[model samples]
Target: MTINFDKMFTFSQPGRRVFGFGTISRVGKEARSLAGGPRAQVITDSKLMELGLVEPVIEALKAAGLETEVWAGVAGEPTQGLIEECRKDIENFAPDVFVGFGGGSSIDVAKIVAGLMTNPKDLHDYFMKDLGVGRFENPSKPLLAVPTTAGTGAENTWLAITSLDDVEGKVGFADPKIIPPRALVDPGLTMALPPGITASTGIDALTHILEPYLNANTNPFTEALALQAVRIVPVFLPRAFKDGKEKEARFQMMMQATLGGLTLNYGGVSEGHLIGQMVGGRYHIPHGVSQGIALPYCLRYSLDIFPEGLANLANWWGIDISGLDIKEAGLELIKASVDLLKELGMPWNLRQIEGVNRDDLPEMASAIATQPYFITTAASCCRKINTEKDYLWILERMYEGNFLD
Candidate 1:
């Protein structure tokens, strides 16, 4: 097995993590500790509010004597326009501490609001070139993130993702200053997620773990988290999907998802996230769904370049391949990935996405080729993708459900 022992890798100093049932009640005191008598803005979506999740946190904050205001307008995927609206509300609230109190979308918006409130810059100022306008260097306010769903690992990451309509894709802003000061992960919060959402979000967590684990740049720190996360998901995701009421499954998935986020923040992701973003950007497909569709094929494509990594992954899946060659072990890993996807009810190809067609592949492939992460991350994969033509080849295979080919 080849290891990049001499390669340099950067690891983020993660914030404090408080995990367990009923931890949501700690939000009030936690917020206050981060900022005394904090006037907090709780960024979330209307659906969460309707689900009766928002009121309890609001009440808890009020009980702790903190002034709390709820911004429940965030809907669908985040965009520059959506974030600007959130920033306006944050400025009015003048919060000393911010709380991201829902899924990835809500957390992403709150991260942006927290950063922009202190720095006062346009969203575009911080975005990488392929996704947005420019860069902004500044610190954001302290934030406490409470994730309601087990996906996106938004609570653990410093990167904030948003859509650019002009480019019809997702872009991100990354800096250490934007990492949340505290993360409250309560598995109880995820018990109400619909089966479809539970499956999609769980798969998204798997993607975050698996992509970076197989990347050429992966180091020991990332490998530890990724190995644990990958091991847990195949077992727990199906259990959680089968019954959201299962407390044990919910709890494990929550922890694994956060670990996946940590892996992405530290080691970075590869072609799965790259192509997933392209599809999501173009079709307005939900992020997790796109990731679910892209991951298996992306893994298959990595077989030759990352045989050792894939063989190890096969073992993680509990696939015994003691006497098999590297290629055989890698193939078993791909099959295990497919079986897991089937158990989760995730669509494994572009054909499954309603209203999508092969004709859409070229445009999506072209757009991803322009994104720098796709180029950089894929450079480390088995099949390096350097041009739109290369991305198109991959996309065509994805569109046709050609995992074996």
Candidate 2:
């Protein structure tokens, strides 16, 4: 198949990305620079605070003469209520800059809070207008993202995701203005993450790379980042999962996660993300966990449409599928993906996750079928999504753990 070099694509660059070990200590200086003053708000979850990650940032901010307010209330996938709760704090304290200081959930909450400060609208107001949300006229205050986990690349992307109480699935607020002005990603912050989170988030980052790499909207820049992440994740993720204290493995996983973010910004994602969002939103599954459950089958389902892209991914994993048909080659990639999940002791099927049932398949399928992602444009998505039945089929297979069959 011939490639389309003429395909037009846009990329969003993070303002100031400081990636390395021990860089969280620079949060104070970065916040001061962005805030143009000493007032800063640190948004994170109670878990990270309990793990002793939040204090260092607060202490560093104080050491830099910055007055800091701690909002460690983030929980689960951020919801409208969670965002509103944080919004109240932002409204009352009114800091000069906002620092999102933990994982994707924490960072996502901060993104909405920052936007709310300037937009003065409901969360639904910022939903993609196509989805009947309001429009964002002004950019939010200079928000800084400090991600603790290696997935959800929410730190670098323009999209903020939330689970709405009144809605059945996740909603994304896609606005260029929401992209953070700076990100301080330190691998040390992830060292203490348990193996379960490490594996799940690693798969999420990998899916971020995979979907965009297969997206019809892909460009050279996005493909480059996605390919690099593809080459790195399968190797480093296992190491990070087995031993969270492995610095080099943790560092590499962190880098790939950010690259995954960049890929989503430029190339966009396809079926897997759409389906994963449904499972995550309805089942209350973590984004990464749902990605782990959905990606293998999603990729296999799209193999015929994304042969070249999926074939290249197999090659990157060092599989020699030269003589095999695309289906065979794609199967090789599927086996590799599932093997990685097993090696990491992660659940490769929906059944493995507690509370999942076959009864939920129809609702999950309907949710994904209505997503903007399933409604493709002229050249946005590579796969031909048969939303009416294909989604239900995938969900059933996922529920049954029917990978090879």
Candidate 3:
């Protein structure tokens, strides 16, 4: 970890608090002021309700003297209309505080709903580059994020990964207002996650940290969180996956995920996130699973284009390519990632997963190039993306059974 001296960039402070295991007892007092004015709308999915976690969150709100309404409609690839419908579900409540209590998708829905409380626009208006219908002049409502899965750092972030209309691509809607006022991380909440979910989301956390750590935009503050996530995910993910009942392991993974989410606030992300978004929107692959599949290749290819500060990266992640060329160092990181993905039972390449056809490759490549955040943030030292052809070349490799020659 690099020594970063900027005090304003510090992650842990007094007002922004975190209570680990058994902290559910404090939800009432902690949430009181935020939930005071109107009914508190709790945004969560039916799976969580079935799993019995919603009962605890509801009990906490009622204990806090907050009127609560349950919005549980989120399902399968949350669409723009779904967000609008979710906005409608709570439109009647006019709730003062929104509590997101599921995986990343529900939490993202909660963020969009909070934005719509004051800003009267649909998801289409907030697209980043094109089709800009909404301008984010107004602030978002107060929000509280309590994540169910161990990944999607949505709880700690202000960016919402929303689906776009007509394009079949995903774009982020970002603003400081989108950031939740508070994050409630209870590792106990993640203890019940099934193995497949545990792997995909855990990989998402890994990408969140890795991309920021690699991107040139990273600062010392976010770097700390990202690096810590990198160090901890390897150790705790396996423990949490093998035994969901491992309270300590689950708690640690949750905290680490919070750290990963917070990282985006400071370090931001690069191509890995953008490519993952493309694969996810087009193929219906889980967000983290697809990102994990492409990361090593992105690292290997992008490194050739940017050499500045990479030796430092090689040393930071403790890869052995230090004595060799920069490309070798990049390969070292990818090799380590490949080993970890296989161990966690995630797909290493597109062919490893079923149902995705070869015919879709061109459209998928174009979709990735269409959204340029990854290209822009590849590395501070990295140049503009070579061409549309360059993107297709990489996507063609993805069509193969192997990312490596």
For model 1, what is the error of residue 202's alpha carbon versus the real structure, in angstroms, after optimal superposition? 0.6
Candidate 1 residue spans exceeding 4 A from truth: 128-136, 165-168, 372-385
Give the residue spans of candidate 3 off by over 4 A. 1-15, 126-135, 306-325, 371-383
Tens-place lDDT digits, model 2, residues 145-221:
99989998889888777766665556667678889999999998899899999998989989888787776776777
Mind giving the per-residue lDDT tens digits that candidate 3 earns over 272-378? 67666777766688887888887767666566655434444555656666368766665666677788888888888788778877777777666555554444334
lDDT of 2 at 174: 69
- In the predicted model 1, the residue pairs found to clash are none
**Against the true structure, what is every candidate's RMSD?**
2.0, 2.1, 3.6
Task: Write candidate 1's Cα lDDT for 1-405 as tens digits.
Answer: 456778777888678999998898899889888874458889999998988889989998888888989999889878878988878866876998889999998998888778888777666556666534233576678899999999889999877777665644566666677789898999999999999999999999988888877876677876777777767988999999999999999999998888888888777888788888888767788889989888878887788678888888788778899999988988888878878878878788888878898887887787777665455445544235457886677688778888777
Candidates in order have lDDT scores of 0.81, 0.81, 0.71
**Which regions of candidate 2 are displaced past 4 Å?**
128-135, 371-382
TM-score of each: 0.94, 0.94, 0.88
* Candidate 3 overall lDDT versus native: 0.71
- lDDT, candidate 2, residue 143? 91
Lowest-sum lDDT 10-residue window in model 2? 371-380
